[model samples]
Target chain A: MYIADRSGEVIYHPDQQLIYAGLTEESPVADASLSDGIHKEVIDGIPQLVLVKTVGYTGWKLVGVIPVKNLAADIDELQWFGVALLLFTVFLLAFVNTHLSEHISRPLSRLNLAVKAMEAGKENVEFQEEGCEEVQHLAHSIQSMVSTLRHLMDDIIEQEENKRRLEMEVLQSQINPHFLYNTLDSVIWLTENGRYEDATRMVNALGKLFRISLSRGKTVIPLKDELEHVRHYGTIQAIRYKERFEIRITAEPDTEGLYTLKLIVQPILENAIYHGMAAMDEDGEITVHAWRKGGDLYIDVQDNGLGIPGEMLDHLLDESQPLKHSKGSGIGVRNIHRRIQLFFGPEYGLEFFSEPDEGTLVRIHLPALNEEQAAAYQKEGTGYETKA
Target chain B: MKRKHKNLIQLGILAILSLLVILSLFIRDISWPEKAERRVEISVIVRESDSSIWSEARQGMAKAAADYGVELRFLALGESNSVSEQTELIRQEIKNGADGLVVVPAQTEALEVIVKDNPKIPVVTMESSLEGACISVMPDNVWVGEQLAAAIEEDFSEGHVLLVDAAPGSSGIRARLEAAEESLTEKGFTVLRCGADFTVETIEGVDAVIFPEPESAVHALQLLDQNGKTSSLYVAGTEERILAGLEYGVIRGVVAWSGYGVGYQAVEQAASAVLGKELSEPVVESVLVRKEEMYEIENQKILFPIGH
Candidate 1:
């Protein structure tokens, strides 16, 4: 509030800052000198409700400059207060809902994902125990159930692995007696033909083959020993068939210490002699080659003889089909395929490649294990079979 | 924490804070003690309330009263500037529920004493200050003297100037007389003085006269006119006779201070004091007028307030 005289000189003002600073400009309220009333005027861009009163004889004006908004300041305060209150409530509700959802819904979401993973057959899925007590208890219960289920599954797998080992052992036992019967028959033929030297060599080869096949009651042996067993079996077969087929056995120097399932090659050799070469008019050719590739061992047996028919060859190593017909030692090639899978894992098995009238080749695939690794393999039984 | 408990806590705190805010606003409404419903009544005590000299001043007071939403009562003090009568009026107005006072002090000392005695009643003084007035609306007498002296210098290089002084008890009268004397002396003039003991002999060697008060000017002019003396006069008023004297060459010039400003600012200060508005001492205007410019628009506004 200030007072200005007739000539617009500010004789008195409430604000001394302006007077002391010598601010020489006339106030906008000076215009109030024109009359004595309330008037609306703008000062410095702000609309003011200016009330002017003339000092009676002096023509001085007393101006009360009130901002227009100040007139309704109470109402404005109420409106702002209401708006602020509403915003605060909404914010508070959102905060509570967010925290509640995090406490209850978030853990449930994680639990749902874990259940999905379990349904999808992932056994090593990481489980989290969190959120409210109910959710925590649910998670704990599920984790326990999954733990017990895994243990039961493990027991089933161990039983299946032991059963497979027993089956392979029985198959090996059947192979041995059958091979002995065939060799004894061949020995009798040799002795009756007055081939005493060949009979002695056949008996000696049989002794060495049987000795190596049952080496310290082990199912796995060095490739060289297996090769030696193969050579002795080849000698016996040569004496029995009167050199009807020539068999060449060769192995890479790196495969010397690599071991394989015992008695694996001898049956294949027998099948090559009786089923593969027996029908060939011309002398047959058999090639046995062993080599190491990556961490695995490969043994290929190729026979240049009457190739098995395409339809029959397709089922030769198919374990899903039964080997209703058997030849040589009464052990079908499919049985040997199953024995390799059960003993060394499905990835290590026999693969047959043949075409009609183009000879047959059976590739033996096995993990390349030295002596110490083979012992671990015998102890562990088998890698869990993920046949799919 | 439980959801139910947390909600309760939040609501309780909000309600308490809201109640506190409402309570504070309510307390403010009650504790401040509202002013009375009736308009404030201010008693103005002057020498003579119906004097023509107060026509513009009364109008100024009326306008200020209307602006401040107060009421004014210009009390009649008979035809005299009597301290006893003015003091009796002040006491009566106080008893009659007058919120404040505007005193055209009859005697500065007596009024100051009265003001000190009635400390609760705010008083605004005009033209004089002794003590305890919330505000004093006075004139710049030195400027008035300078203006009058400059007017004389414009007509004459030097002269024997008679300074008519009155109301020795009033500081305003003393200040005006001293200012005029000092200014005229600075102009290398021969200065003479008149007081309550004045006679025609005091005007003997005087080439011109300066009256510092309106009453003194009026009294001196009537005496000069009665005695057929046409000595040039410079008076401190825009009274009718002073204007007439200026027109007819009896008065060379008039140094009239704004009488209206004194009344208006005095009432304003009084109203502000009782109404709880801040105030400060104010100075009213004093203008110089000669016969040549007295009829001009701005000068006419000052000298003749009723028109234009």
Candidate 2:
């Protein structure tokens, strides 16, 4: 405690050295005329809480000076303790929050990721039945639904595949008799013309073509064998037409290893010779070209014969429409289209482009599958499938 | 949801309790007591003010007073070495009901009568001895002087040494110088005495300059620097001067004591006499300091009297 006179002279202080020293010049309390209350002031850059009371009848102020920090010592300690407790509590809550979120969302997030993987064509995904009852039930439901859907889809695909294979066999058998009859008729005519060597060659080509057609009961064969079959068919047709038309078959060396449906090119060749080149007066030309472009093999048959009218050409590949002058079982171009669509999906099929008297070009599009791919396509009904 | 709400309520209650505890702590006042019980008042009188040495001594006295629960009042005789002013301050403290006295007498003989008359009050003299004082707390000056001479002798067996005498009036300083001179002379060395302002020309032929006081050592260092001389210097003084001289290579070694320890011991001795307790010892210990061994623990205690 310190006492200062009315004129601001320091009269008494517990620190005796500060007394008799000029207090009026240094202390803010000396200049303050506070009546009787606590006042905060700065003295020599230190904050002080000064309690000022006027001495009765003396007009001297009795001041009690305490540093502001000293007054808040207890409070400062308590504040530090509170802050430490708060930090510890927040850290604990963070740990609990992490554990809680992991317990609640971990299984759900795993299930979501499994569903996404399924959408990306990953099969037979297994989801864990953990977490809450609702989440476990949802996982169980999804697992059952996926299993059922997979079984149903497999059954439908197998039945459809069997039906398409049966139809292909039937169509393939229908072409055999007509092809043999035409070839034998040519062989007979060659012998009648006294050309015994040509007749022997025609008979040998017919024998080779039939051997490749019945290739161990396999529906798909290498393009090399398919082209050879077409060559034999053209030789017999050339003999029958008697030099009125020419048949030229060419294939790229790279396409020799690739596979195609059996009797595919033979039926198309028959259509071109009978329907396209039969009524031609001058010598007509039939060119068969096979090559590989990207992931597809294209075989185009161009015949410089009397081109079919646009109306008939448009309805040629439509099975629902009957041909005006079709000679076969009325399923010629449409059967090829259906067989290709059933084997390789609708994206790989037949496309025809023609102009009147300018000849017709038939493009047969098929996937360039190797030996292993063709075997997988036949067994598991799976291949390098492309979208339409 | 019910469990979560209950947890939030518990958290809220805990928060409120914490806030209340903090608020209660904030409102509580922390201040010195208005009055202490049966406290004895002791007055300390020193000859000079505004000196770092005296300020450190006052710190020791204040610590003792706090430890012993005694009310202490420190009185200074302005800044001069005035025996009359110090004597008058002691008389004033006695009149003001001082229960005991700790004085560093300006002149030991001049304050004898006043100390003799104050028979009821216990008195302790510091840095100097009085004939009738209850006790005297001071450094062993004779031993310090011998140590200083031995330190210098380590480098020089025989040389003409110049001793710069700064405190000619203090008997304690005089006795230390006499002992140093006697020890150095007995070692087959020549000793010469000079004032603080001794020029480089006066010290040209001297192999070493010995200063028993800090001021004189500082003065000799300045002279050596100004003259660009390479003479070896030694001091028996405070740590500030000795450490600085050693660091700058101006002085080779020091013979010193802990000033703070001396002051602390003085107040302790005074309080012991006041409480009718037997005194342990009157003299404080000194240390021999060298540049190489200055950082050793025992020597460092003397060099840094205070922990800092």
Candidate 3:
């Protein structure tokens, strides 16, 4: 039943029929949604307490009645509280996750960066060590392992490099003694022939070569220094196989700053003089050309003498085999090949090509010397690189 | 009536006997609470130039000596502020056959080499002591500055301040200046800095000059007096600073630490270490005194006798 208190008349009922009972004509209950006193009656009927609030409408009073039992069920208290708690929990979790990730990611990224650097052969970057225990421990372990591996690999490389260097030094020493003996023979011949200037030049070139060779016990030389060595070797070859071969040297201005591993270019030229052109009837020409292309420095020594077969070209750079085919001049070329590869790495090395009855060309590629290297070159001069 | 009189006489006799027993017990306990008969000679080295702190420090040494019933040989080094003089005095103390030495180092860096070489002697240092001493007893300077900074921070939204580091390597002064600078700067303030080995010549272009100890205030006043500039200066330091400020009427505000409190703490620490007694708290304590809260530091004793 529904009623309007102002009109004193019924407004609504479960039975929606216009039925007027005993009520005043001017009663406001006539237009009420429910009978005015029905809420009070219902509260009286139930044992539980009912809360009723009078809500004002535009032209009527809305009596909102709520039973104590239905209040919780209808309002859905747990659902709303659960939603709020869930939202707060989600926010808290998000905050923790962000904080944790930020902490973990920094050290992890540093470790990753360190590992990448090590892989890229940079053994000098220090990684930050912090964060959660597992990550910290992992970082520490990785760092430790990297350190151990780095030290061990460094030792191995150093040992191999040292062995290669010792062998190269021994080879150089052997060459020095032989050249000394040869120079003494040349001096004797010059004294007998009375050509004092040529003898003196020979003796001086030998002294200069050995002085640069033994160079305060170092192995590295500037391109200019190496070219000077080349000139000396050419002098020696000119003295040894006179009128058999003529060597020409050309250098780019910018390529002068490039550094070569000590005694690298000379050995190749020696091989060209002794093996390639010694038997040629006419004067054979050996041209040593150096130029910079992009970031790389290339040195090519080409000789117009006996060309190489395609089959022997593969094993020509191999260090183990002695050069047995053409009076064994491959020893010097192999040494040059190994040195170029060892210094600049496998990606850069000596490239050989020959056309039958035309000529044999030896090409050597090296890293472009940087400012620090130039500074080191100036400081160390020509001494320590061969030793190191 | 006759029985009552007899009972009263017996009660009087019992009361007299109880009083005698109580007196005997009290006298016996008084006679022997602990042994106070160990006589020892100690050297007190003061690195001051006839300043009031030096005088108060001597007074403290005298009190300690009298309480312990020991002879105190006092060595006054330098013209008060010279670290070189203090260094020279330490060498003299070592040479004088003093049993134990107490030195207040004048400079932090100077003591590094001096203290490193000397060993096998019990060296007790006090008052803003840092570097090269085995045992150091000084009030927390950073806390003092922090308290002052926090107080200033409460009133203003932001503050622009200048710090005058009176002594550079004096740990007490350095720590205070650092704390104040850090706190004020942390709260977003522009801080200008200056360093002086002696007195602050001028603070006109500054908001505040934080003097870590009272002696520095005296030096500052002396510097100002020489120029005939009696400008009111806002300063902070020890209880001696509070007293100096009150006497000079130049300081706009005074922040002080309890000298007696530091002394009491040192004594308690020494006693605990001597008698193998456990400490209830950390051996060091610090407090602050501001102008608005001058009552807290007014009547407090600067140095108290250990026994008294």
Candidate 4:
């Protein structure tokens, strides 16, 4: 409240000191010199409800001022508080929204990861088979599809194995007819030369060789029986060679019980006598020695005769070679090497060590299978235990 | 990589929220007053916050506050003349951390004890002086008295002059009364002493009346007008009614001082004392304004300040 005389001289004021000091400007009330009334005005740029009343007959004007900002201060504070609360609510909602979205999408995300792994050619993809019914059913269906694919793949492999075994049987059946014709020639020559005892011995050896070679149409035989077949072949061969070269057959003590592919040693012995010992005069010797080395059986057909040259020895087991100098099976050494690998994996096959004029050693390698494993192998083709 | 990116976004949001909390605590106007650069706070305690008596003084203090970068608050008092109540207000202002005080003292001697007890808060008084006051800004009482006497002497050489004493307990009003009495006596007039509560019986034989205080000047003028007494009145200071009295031919002369100057210098001196600056004692001018010359530019500025 403020008071001023009729002529604007200040009489009293809340800040009367400034009016008396004459240091402040006149307020709008004083400047207007208002009469006795209530008024609305702006004082110092503040809207105020002012009352202009005369102090009795004194002609003094009293002015009251109230700034509007003071009236709405609480409202302004409430507005700011409302804004802060709204911001907090929005932040909390966003936080919860993300979590809820993750909850609904979690299982789908796992399923997608599994499917992607499968698409990237992974063989072992795990499906959780959880979450919504659609996702679980999809996982189950994919697992069943994978099981069917594995069975089909196994059937295809079995078919391929059967085809390979049939091709090997065809090669085994092509044992050369020249060996039988030559043995018959020896028998006929002995009978006409008046060596009837020698003829009978040769006939007996030929019959034993043929019986063992037939072996009930079986592809696998015992090691002792294989040695017997090779011995009969050697007797017939010695009679044909007119004792120009001697044949020796021996085996390690425990090796004769092991199983091997039939007709394997007989072919190698035939090669040794005809090709390796062809140039030997009377001092030629062919030794058939068999031994068990670890879990494998090895038969060495060695001839102290003319050995193969370096160039011929490198490709002796090459499948591309069509023929060889042997009066035995035309399937040749390369075919025999391949057939052994097909039965016992590639680790068991023929290995040749030869030198010119020093003789040749043809080592036939086969798995040392006991009786139970031999039966399994003859039935299922490759049921023997493989080396680690 | 996608997971890492999402985590980074969450961390960014958390960082922003943390930053907002920190800003709200430290930077969104926590209202902690700055120690080194904040304005010096001063509180003015007075009998009433809305009274017109403090208008000019508040303006001057406000001007000084603006100039010195000081913060000022005027606390209103419930009791106009209660020493204890004003003293408690002073304590409250000091307790609220006032650096200085501008007191329009109601009881000079009694309030002096409170002011002196709080020596750390510099004090400047208005209208009167207190012993504990670091400075006081007031109109010179002797100058006002002599001006009122000189204005009276111009019209009357001799008369039964009734001297009215208002606020006898106030030292400033008492000095003004004594000075006016001495000046009136020296001018060869019959000076009669009277209290501000005078009845018609006291004014019966009076040829002239003199008021020693501004508020009482207007009050005495109304009493004379009511009694239909036209004896010319002289006053040591002027209020609005005294000006009206001058127009009504009831007022002979008015010795008016500029309250604005006194109020301005009070806060100026108080702020100076607070800042350890040298004190300036300013003289507030008093003028003898008559009805005929009240409109003159020179006398009007002092007698009727522009826009109050």
DockQ of each: 0.04, 0.01, 0.00, 0.10
lDDT (10s digit) by residue, model 1, range A1-388:
6777777665565432223222223363356555778888776677888778887887777867778988887885576567656656665665676567657987898999999999998868877999989999999999999998888778668757664665566456545776688789888988998989999999999889778866876777788898899899899888777787899999998898888887788778878888788887657889999999989999999898777788877777765767666666665666667767766666778888887777889899988989898887666655435221
TM-score between candidate 4 and the true structure? 0.43
- Give stretches of model 3 more than 4 Å off: A1-167, A170-175, A318-331, A375-388, B1-308
Residues B134-181 of candidate 2 have per-residue lDDT tens digits of 888777767767777887788898988887765454556666788789
Output the chain A TM-score of model 3.
0.59
Candidate 2 residues lying further than 4 Å off, grouped into runs, are A1-3, A6-88, A91-167, A181-199, A214-224, A240-244, A251-262, A280-284, A290-298, A318-325, A329-331, A338-349, A356-358, A365-388, B1-308
Query: Candidate 2: which docking quality band?
Result: incorrect
Tell me the whole-model lDDT of each prediction, alpha carbons only. 0.75, 0.74, 0.61, 0.74
Ranking by lDDT: 1, 4, 2, 3
Candidate 4: stretches off by over 4 Å:
A1-124, A127-388, B1-20, B23-123, B157-161, B174-192, B201-207, B258-285, B293-308
lDDT by residue (A1-388, candidate 3, tens digit) is: 2323344332332211111211112222322434434343233355333222234553444433345566567456565555556655555565566566667777787788788997898857776678788878997888788788778777657756654665466455536656668778987898789988888888888878776776565556678877887888688668766557788888998886777777678767877777678778667999999888878888999999887787788788776666665432234565666555555466787999888778899888887775567557545433232335
True contacts recovered per prediction: 0.00, 0.00, 0.00, 0.21
Each candidate structure's TM-score, on Cα atoms with residue i matched to residue i, is 0.50, 0.38, 0.36, 0.43
Say which docking band candidate 1 falls in: incorrect
How high is the DockQ of candidate 1? 0.04
Measured with C-alpha atoms, the lDDT of residue B74 in candidate 2 is 78
Clashes of each: 4, 0, 28, 29
True contacts kept of 1: 0.00
Residue A356 of model 3, lDDT score:
78
